[model samples]
Target chain A: MAVKLFYEALHDGLEEEMQRNKDVLVIGEDVGHYGGSYKVTKGLHEQFGDLRVLDTPICENSFTGMAIGAAMVGLRPVIEGMNMGFLLLAFNQIANNAGMLRYTSGGQFKIPIVIRGPGGVGRQLGAEHSQRLEGYFNNVPGLKIVHTSTVYNAKGLLKSAIRDDNPVLFFEHVLLYNLKEEIPDEEYYVPLDKADVVRSGKDITILTYGRMRYHCLDAVKTLVANDIDPEVIDLISLKPLDMETIVASVKKTHRVIIVEEDMKSGGIGAEVAASIIEQCFDYLDAPVIRLAGKDVPVPYNGRMEETVIPYPKDIVRAVEDMLALRV
Target chain B: MVQEQLAPTKYDPIDRQEALMLYRDIVLGRTFEDMCAQMYYRGKMFGFVHLYNGQEAVSTGFIKQLRPDDYVTSTYRDHVHALSKGVPPRAVMAELFGKATGCSKGRGGSMHLFSAEHNLLGGFAFIGEGIPIALGAAFAAKYRGTDQVSVCFFGDGTTNNGQFFECLNMAVLWKLPILFVVENNLWSIGMQHHRASSVTDIYRKADAFDMPGYLVDGMDTLECRQAAIKAIKRARAGEGPTLLECSTYRFRGHSLADPDELRDPKEKEFWRKQDPIPKLTKFIQEQGLASAAELKLIEQEIRAEVEDAVQFGEDSPEPPVDELYRFQFAEDE
Candidate 1:
């Protein structure tokens, strides 16, 4: 076993996949020699040459569309965005081309393309740079969405994503990149649509994924001290949502609190809450609650940032509110 | 005398055999579109049908010069491109009818025909969307050590889209083997050329990429073929990309539902006179290449071929309802 950071694991996974498959290529701005803005693709260009690891111009929409086209013609392309904020320029390609190609083409074409970039707030990054777009992509059909919380899962999940024959939105949290974890020293792949149970409990279900997953676990630890046993479910894949896991969690706990870093209104948490209400309404002991970031631009100040984003205290308060409902 | 030299009176010097094939394919596309328009009005096929009526010469002239392995991506007005790229007439007609036997298994209607066998990549409904995709196809072909070029066909209206400029820049910068064909059909929907663009000339738009751009008479099938052959050859020779602006017209409206009363009767008259099939027929006869009776026999053969295709589509079974969820997610179990 080796101690790997989320970025390292992602790098290793991509490098191995590219070396194994000649059809696999990497395309993005600063992805070649500079090794990406986040350094996730560091040293790849030197190792693979310019052909396998390409440095594209600052044209996200065109390059993203190009990646989809390459994928259609038997190439597996991994398009890296400098940040999720920059992905706005590429929304047209992703939503219209990548998300609709397979269906529009009646399955004549397959897009084995992965668009990777860091999402969620970190440090003092201003409003534009700190947005979370998982909700936006998760709402789009014909795409697989994945967010990883640890190095092992990131690497495994990325490998699985590369091998997947569908277009995928691979969201990597900026804060989780440097966080180290033990990764198995062997080739492994994780299934795309299965949820991972972080901690099992019967009192309340804390549903979340990505960086929020670690925070939810921390909140669970705190809740345990208060004699509140919360079941923490890490939703690995947002699209192709494994409602079976959420429904089962609600059945066991009878109360749910969805914690997400994205804003509350029309967020992914709202969708999850709606699904629970629609499917698991009768079984719920208390109404399903959501703990998410406030609906506003993520502030640049560290003090305001901590208060603006969802934290363990918010999770604890939401759980206490559910308990009050039971009384 | 200037016209003779510029247009090249001798088709032999430019490869006459290839020119003949192009003419035949252009006729085939024109016949197919004419039949579709007639059938569409009779309610034999449903939904939106963007007829490539006057644009036949551009598709036929362009696609004839491409290798079978070369990729062709086109816009919503794409029947001519699909036909020229060798997609079966039966499958295309079935697609227009929204039947399972259609090119895209009935999922895609007229605007989204796709065939991997013939390398007809797809026809994107969104304007200018396929340009970048064609560039990527070119990138892949080059990466695979092949000399195949990818042809991206779009209307003059798509020139305003950012995707078009962005793809053109990338294609030139990367030296991608891409041929951007602008089928300037005089108008986009009811909107005319002047209202929609700063410069009505489509070739000027390609100048921004520092690439070679040519403006040709789209109604002249031989002119279109000659231009496309030069562009495709340059691209295949690793000379990067070129843009060919075919000044064409769509005799039908944007879709089957559109009634083109917005166009001037005089402009329409001017284009009608330049209709490619008749022009090519006249050229073939005057050159004594084919007799009038022989050409009439060819037209009869084309009509029968189209009739058989229509019958084949009408008789084909509809896709089952269970197939609704099919091809939705490619990665899942």
Candidate 2:
């Protein structure tokens, strides 16, 4: 085992995959010589050469669509958006072309492309740059969504996303790049559409993903001090959700609190809460609570931005509120 | 200089066999489209059927220059493009009928025809969406050190899309082997090109990307074929992409449901008089390539082929209900 940062794990995963398959390539703006905007793809261009690690012009729509085309013709392309906020520019290609191509083509084509980049609020980046648009993509069918919270899951899930024969939207938190954790030295792959139980408890289930997973873990420490045993479930796959695991967890705990970085309205928390009610309605001791970003654009002020998104304090308070509720 | 660049370049005269081949392909396309229109009225086909009526020459001319391994992507008016790229008439007809035997297995009806075997990538429903895809295919060919080129066919309105400029810039910058063919049929649905476009000349826009641009007479198959030869040769030789604007006209409305009342009668008559099939027929006769009886025989053969395709489509079964749940993702091994 070796300790590695989240971004290093991602780079190692991509490098290993590229070496294993000649058809696997990376394409995006500054993915080649500049080593990616965040340096997650650092040293890949030198190692793989320009053909395999391509540097494209700052045209998201065309480059994303180009990746789709390359995927159609048997190339497994990993397209890195400089930031997930910029993915809005290529939404048409992602939702319309890459998302619908397989079904539209009647199972004749398989789009094996992974679009990955740092997403969610970071260090006072304003409204346009701080948005976590996973909810928008989660609504799209024919797309598998993955958001990892640890170096292990990040590397394992990213490897699986590259190997899977589908278009995957892999969202990484901007803040988590520097977070270090020990990962296995041997090659490993976590299957898509499965959730991981990070902590085991009985009083309540804490459902979250991406950057929220870390905040929820931080809340777990306070919950333990207050005699509240909360089970933290890191929802790695957003689409084709591992509801089986969630429902089982909810049934065991008899209460749930969902956390997300996206806005509260129409967020993934709403979907998970609805699923819990539908699947295990009778098992609930209290109504499912959602702790998500406030329904407002992220402001440039650092303190105000922190208030808008969920923090460890917010998660702790939400859990307390959920535990106090009566059936 | 832009005007000079748009002028048609001269080439060697087409031989008798090649001319006949062009005539046969165009005739086959027309025959198939006519059957599609008839089938739509008879209620055999569903959805908006965009027939490639007068624009046969554009697809035939450009596709003739492409090798079987070369890629072709087209717009919703794609039946003729698929036919020209060697997709079986029966498969395309079956697709329009939403039959399991169709090219896309009845999932992508009239708007989405794909044949990986023929390298016909797809028929995109949205305007200007296929250009970048074609560019990517060209990139793949170059990355693999292959001689194959990719051709993207779109309407004149597609030039207004942001990706059109973006893709053109990248295609030129990367020197990818691609041919962007704009089938400028004078209208995008009900809107006329001149009114919607700021600059009326579509090929001239290619100059902004520093790419070679040519405007060809879309009504004449021989002229379109000659221009396509030069463009394809340039692409295959790794000289990068060419933007070819084939100024054609669609005799029918945009789709079968359209009444086509927006066009001026006089203007429509002017283009109808330049019908590409008859123009090619005249050239064939003047060149003494075939007798009138031989032409009649060819027409009869194409009609039979169209009838066979219709029957094949009619006989094919609809996809099973379980297929609805399939193809969301590739089946796991």
Candidate 3:
């Protein structure tokens, strides 16, 4: 086993997939010689040449659509979104073309395409640059959404996303790129649409994924010190959501706290909370609580930005509040 | 000087077999579209029906130049384009009827028709969506070191879409083998092309991409075929993409729903005088390429073919309820 950074694992996954299939290619702005804005694709162009590792202009709409077209044919194109915020420019292509191509074509075509990029608030990147737009794509059918919280899952999940016959939206937390984790050297693939329960506990269930998984884990440690054992669930697949695991956890824990880095209103946490209530409402000791980013654009000021998104303290507080509620 | 330049050029000499084939294709398209309109009006077809009535020459002319493996993408006004690309008339008609045997398995109605066998990539409903797709198809062909060229057929309104310019820039930059055919029918729904665009001449926009551009009389099949042949040849030679703007007009409303009150009667009359079906027929007879009786017999055969397609569509079964969930994802193991 070798320890790798989250971004390095991503690069390794892409490199291995490309090596395995000649039809696999990477296309996006600065993905070739520039090695991507995040450098996750560093040296891929040199290794695979220009045809496999393409650098496109700043036309997300056309390039995204082009990747869809390429996917319809024999190629499996992985389009880099630069940042999840930039995906808004190609929203039509992703939602209209990629999401609907297989159904619209009567299953005649398979779009084995992945649109991967860093998302969620990072550093002091202002409103437009920092966004966790998973909610926007989660509502769209015919799309599989994957957000990895660890370097190990990043590599394994990304490999699966690259191989999936359906269009996949892989969102990586910008802050987690350098986070290190031990990954097995042997070939392995993480199955899509399955949730991984990272921590086992009995009192309260903490549901989170992406960057917030780390925050929830941090909060779990504090909760443990305070004599509260919270089960932490990492929701890797956002779309074909692993609600079965969540419901079973809710049945066991009775109380739940959901954490997300996106805006609180219409957030993915709201969907998870709703699903929990609908599935195991009678088993719940208290109402499910959500700790998400404040309903506002991520501000430029470091202090304000830090306050806008959820922190470990917020998760701990939400769990405390949920547990304290009398039912 | 402008008047002298605008004067009609001498017609290119076409042999009897080629002339008859071209005439038959145009007549078939015209006949097929007319049947579609009649069926749509009689309530045999549902949803938005956009007829390619007066634009037969553009599709027939351009598609004739493409090899069987060459890809073609088109806009919502795609019935004639699909026909020209070799999608069976029965399948196209069945698609309009939303039958399971249709090209898109009844999932896509009027606006979306696709056939992998014929390499008719799709008929995209969004105005300029097909442009980038065609570019990608060309990119795939070039990447595989194949000489297959892709053709994208869109209306004048599509030129204004950001994807159109973006695709042009990339197509030229990558030297992709693509031919963008702009069917400038002058109306995007009720909006006129000149009113929506900064420059009225759409072909000239190709110069911005550093690619060759040509404006052809879309009412003339011969002119369109010649221009398309040149563009296709250049693309096959790896000279990169070419933009061909075919100046044509739609005889029908934007869709069956429109009243078509936006166009001037005088302008309509002028274009009616240039109707390509009769124009080709006149040329065929004037050159003694095909006898009047022979042309009439061909027209009769086309009418029978169209009637047979209608029967096929009507006889086809509706998709079962369980089939509704299928085809959302590929069944590949």
Better of 1 and 3 by lDDT: 3
The residue-by-residue lDDT of candidate 3 on B178-221, one tens digit each, is: 99999999999999988999988888888887888888899989
Instruction: Chain A TM-score per model, please list them.
Output: 0.98, 0.98, 0.98
- Candidate 2 local lDDT, residue B217: 94
Predicted candidate 1 versus true structure: per-residue lDDT over B140-246, tens digit per residue: 98889799899999988899888888888888887889999899987989888889999887787777778877888888877877887778888998989888788
Q: Per-residue lDDT tens digits of candidate 2, residues A1-327?
A: 999998899999999999999999999999999999888899998899987999998889899999899888889999999998888999989988899878878887889999999999999888888988988898887999989888999999999999999999999998889989999999999988899999999999999999888899899999999999999999999887899999999889999989898888888988899989999999999888888888998999988887998889988998888887754
Clashing pairs in 2: none
TM-score winner: 2
Using Cα atoms, each model's DockQ against the true complex is: 0.69, 0.70, 0.67
lDDT of 2 by residue, B1-333 (tens): 253343454645778788778888999999999999999999999999999999998988889878999999998999999999999999999999999999988989999999989999999998888988898899999888899999999998998999899999999988899999999998999999999999989989988988888888998887888888888999999999999899899999999999999999999999999999998899889889887788889999999999999999999999998868677787721
Error of 1 at A186 (Å): 1.8
CAPRI verdict (incorrect, acceptable, medium, high) for model 1:
medium
Model 1 misplaced regions, further than 4 Å = A301-303, B1-20, B331-333
Return the clash pairs for model 3, or none.
Answer: none
- Which residue runs of candidate 3 sit more than 4 Å off their true CA positions? B1-13
The number of clashing residue pairs in each candidate reads 0, 0, 0
For residue B247, model 3's alpha carbon misses the true position, in angstroms, by 0.5
Ranked by TM-score from best down, the candidates are 2, 3, 1
Instruction: Report lDDT (CA) for all predictions.
Output: 0.86, 0.90, 0.89
Candidate 2 chain A: worst-modelled 10 consecutive residues by lDDT: A318-327
